[model samples]
Target: MESASLDSRFSKPMLDGNRSAGSLEESVSPKPLPVDDSPSAPPKPPNGGFVAWMQVAGSWCLMFNCWGIVNSYGVFQTYYENEMLVYRTSSEIAWIGSIQAFLLLFIGALTGPLYDSGYFRLLLATGTFLMCLGMMMISICTELWQFVLAQGIVVGLGAGCLFIPSVAVLPLYFSSHLAFSIGVAGSGSGVGGIIYSIAFQQLQKSIGFGWASRVMGFISLVTLVFPLLIMRVRSSNPKQKRKVRKLFDSSALRELPFCLFLVWGFFGFAGVYMPLYYVGSYAIETKIMPPALAFYLIPILNAGSVIGRTVPNYAADKTGSLNMFIPTCFGLAVLSFAWIGIHNTPGLIVFIVLYGIFIGAFMTLPFSAVVKLSPHLGVIGVRMGMLCVICSFGILIGTPVGGAVLRQGGWISLQSFGGAALMVSTIFIIATRVAKVGAHPRQKV
Candidate 1:
């Protein structure tokens, strides 16, 4: 086409052995537009620098408050069942945490488009306020309905608002280090989990549940201040200049690989929170660990996750997110079975740590995989929000189902169920990779 266009503009087909008079005349009459061979390129991400890393730091703070508190639900699960909500069965108590996790992911689906529309600060501030308020509300609650409203509904909504921006912001700042940066920011969940769980554990003993909850709220209020101040969109010009996306766009669902990835996330996460919610209770009930020491299992698990989120994410930058994610899911499946057999403190601790690491890898890498599945950068937030919709349901049912399984058929059935969910997840992730990149193992997806 380029050759034909140039020929038509610069010259006409000539009679045999004769130069076209128009060719020579046409060349001097008007010059044709110059053509460059290469297509125009999009601007590159900054990849690294002061402002970019500052965004990462702010994102880390956001994550600390969002996922961090969610991860600490186990501490509350233990405390409530033993003291406050003892009248309720384990299955019933599990609903509070599951609902909390559910609403965080479900409501997040609506706010992703809002984030793209330059409502980031508004989302963050509203979320942080609700988070602090929910914690304070939790401090005052004695009834089941109050706990659900305060911790499950209010805190969950706050978390949902913050979730997308904390994650999606990194793509604007770093490309090569995207997984690693996300991993680093994501480690805040682990660190946050460890601190909050321990804080609640110690404080509840000395100050009672009400003051303990208030102290945690104060901590959330303080930590969130940093993110609120430093975080900004990558562009000085508002993203509101772009068309705002719809709240319920599921266009990515039309793609086969994405659908398969959603299945992978759904079943995989269905089992992920089971141990986190029940490990403390399981340890004490079975006499595998001392009662006083059992609550530490959550912190131990999160500490492992801090490492899991980091090293595997660094490796994912090299090996590909789907590749790293498949094996991690497999490890979690294996560890779920391993969790069923522990009879001693050392064994329980080992299971907790490994579970934490694998689940941490599972949590962070899936987002990267979702981003890779995205057709373009512009739709990543929406795609991520969609992914969260699938994952949130998994989280919603995971713990309560485990509690029901525990009540009905004992730990064996509960552990087996969790393992099977993850096994299916691993298989589908492998399928997602094959669908995306075909049978070539060496090629990056």
Candidate 2:
């Protein structure tokens, strides 16, 4: 179904000496065991060990502080409307989040290339500083423009720097279990969502808006330290000089599966951000749930995601990432469609929980799938950056588009647009699978 040359080109180059005995796939055995390598060469991943597990934990905390806070934007969306920026139109306020989401992914264009050049500590340290600083700045901001600068652009840029490296490092640690490791780290987003949303809600009531944000900033500062100490580049070629380049990976763009997957991410994000940014407002506007319960909807959805992110990825290792991805994409589309018809409280609850689970799985698998198609593990950071850059445009516009549609045609129009984007994305997802492993059901792609 796909080009034969692409398969041959995908294999890794063998190192000199004993490493020349096997292919890269052979080097990555099914079990999580350490590989033997030359002392002068780069480090081989242990796959599973106290040191390796600690790396994953550090990455988890980074993801929690970065994307986790972004995932919880729905809580902010609701609060902006009801209290803080009450005078602003929904579309105006929505821009803050759209810009935040956009920059978080867009800046990967630069950070990804930097990460590939062995600047792990610099990226992680700089990102943590900017993110914490942004949060503290948000505490004192009272204007829309100030929020835009502090929360949207600064925080978003920090997140991109931290998120790309945190994810890229996992492939270096676990080849056989890459998907499961990514899922575990990615699950931090769900945990952060639950914790931050709850904290934002309770703290707003007790200490007011400014101090609530400052408290969260303080917590992020504390959590960020673990990653700084434990996470590091494998440093296999200790003496290799780093090369600087523009963020784009021109070579990766020529590959068919890679091209197809980027198309899928572009449309997929158009739908993905809709629920994460609007579910809180939807519950309140529909009046199916009370204000108190509606506020907790994001947390409830995130709670389900914690389970969804971890369990499906374990299955994905056995069944293949693309195999699991198709169903998750379908589920996201169906849920978007279903949201329009939901009227009762119980139905809303059920829908949110299912939405959380499916979307979590939907977002987690693509990283593993993309890495599998990559021609060189060394450039995985650049390839991932390119994908995120393409995906960034869709995220940039997703919330604002939804807000505009909601204003003009109400929830039905908004949900219909989201559902349509997701359904269209599935075609690309399937096409990518066909390109990778053809139509065979039994193949592990």
Candidate 3:
């Protein structure tokens, strides 16, 4: 999801001993002045420096694997539907991408705690191996189940392991310009999508699917190594796992604004990727463009996202993340409907570009919104993790459901279904904002 919430993403890692969160501010002192938490680390953060920015760089690399690959699965969806998995329905093939996306986020509940327990290096090495191994296995896969197993589960879990730590450590380093830093790192999702889509699109035509997939895997393995070397987070004693709480901690879910935000995410995300997963296939089906040109849509959308992810976040830092986030959700809802009107080549391209910008902002803002909306510092991780997990379920069920709709209702219905879902999601997102800040339009919230 590349959901970049701060200490909710970063709080625990900043302290000297890697002391778990929640009790730190209280255990060390009863003083009302918010001066000290753990004596082991400095009272203030090293907000800007070479090392701090490198963490951003490493996270950018991680986003390439975590979401870049997931977003580009549209190319695979088209290829599988046309060539490899003709026996399968679009709904059936979508499970591969859906489950891949699901596990990448679903396991956040577990990975978040384990990372806090000082398992960073172990998770990184193991995740990188699994990602490369899964891609290699994809090269040889002949069956639908094989693709699902290799790409869906193995690679999904590997990304999940790497993802939590990628966003988690950022808070320990920065404070004032946190959202901008995360936006830069988060943009890697778009960067990865563009490169990987182009790689597979060009290579598979020349070398065939097996080697094309393996080449992507090779890139994943090599590029991933930089993050392993450059990213450095000191760990706590494995035994003293203080402050680590579970992702779906029950107490956090009971909050109204948080729960409402979860609703917005679930339905909004359900419709969000419908276009991304199906646009290429739609172009081919409608004959608006040949397969040659249709292939570029994925890369083009991702290319637009390169700006969408960073620019909106930079703006959000001033306007407030959710302040910008709510309108972006509305833009996505509008674009999903506008996609229905795009019949000609230019219109389709415009649709893709606008969708890219809106969705990129949509994908980037949630973690920041969650961080600000949290009731207190102690449970930010709990709240943010819950938001991510619930949203993962939405991503899991969304596109396959769209495929089923596509099967029954045709493209108009498919577009309508996606649009309607986003509208509902937009309503809920507005409700969440209103609930948080009482419909005060002038207020920055």
Which number leads on TM-score? Answer: 3
Q: Candidates 1 and 3: which is better by TM-score? A: 3
Least accurate stretch of 10 residues (summed lDDT) in model 1? 11-20
Clash count of each predicted structure = 0, 2, 7
lDDT of 1 by residue, 218-249 (tens): 99999999988898775423322544655543
Instruction: State the lDDT at 13 in candidate 2.
Output: 17
lDDT of each: 0.79, 0.79, 0.81
Best by lDDT: 3
Error of 2 at 440 (Å): 2.4
lDDT by residue for model 2 (1-445), tens = 2324332232221222233223334432221212235455444556689877888898899888887898888898899988889898787898998898889888867776577566889998898899999989999999999999999998998888898777877766665566788889989989998999999988988999999999989988899988998887675565755455445656676778788899999999987778777877888877877677888988988888988899999897777778888889988998999988888889988998999999889768777676566654434555667888888898888778888988898889999999999998998999988887689888776
Candidate 3 C-alpha lDDT tens digits along 145-223: 9999999999898888888878877877766566777889999999999999999999999999999999999999988
Candidate 1 residue pairs that clash: none
TM-score of every candidate relative to the true structure: 0.88, 0.90, 0.91
Which regions of candidate 1 fall more than 4 Å away from where they truly are?
A: 1-44, 236-240, 247-251
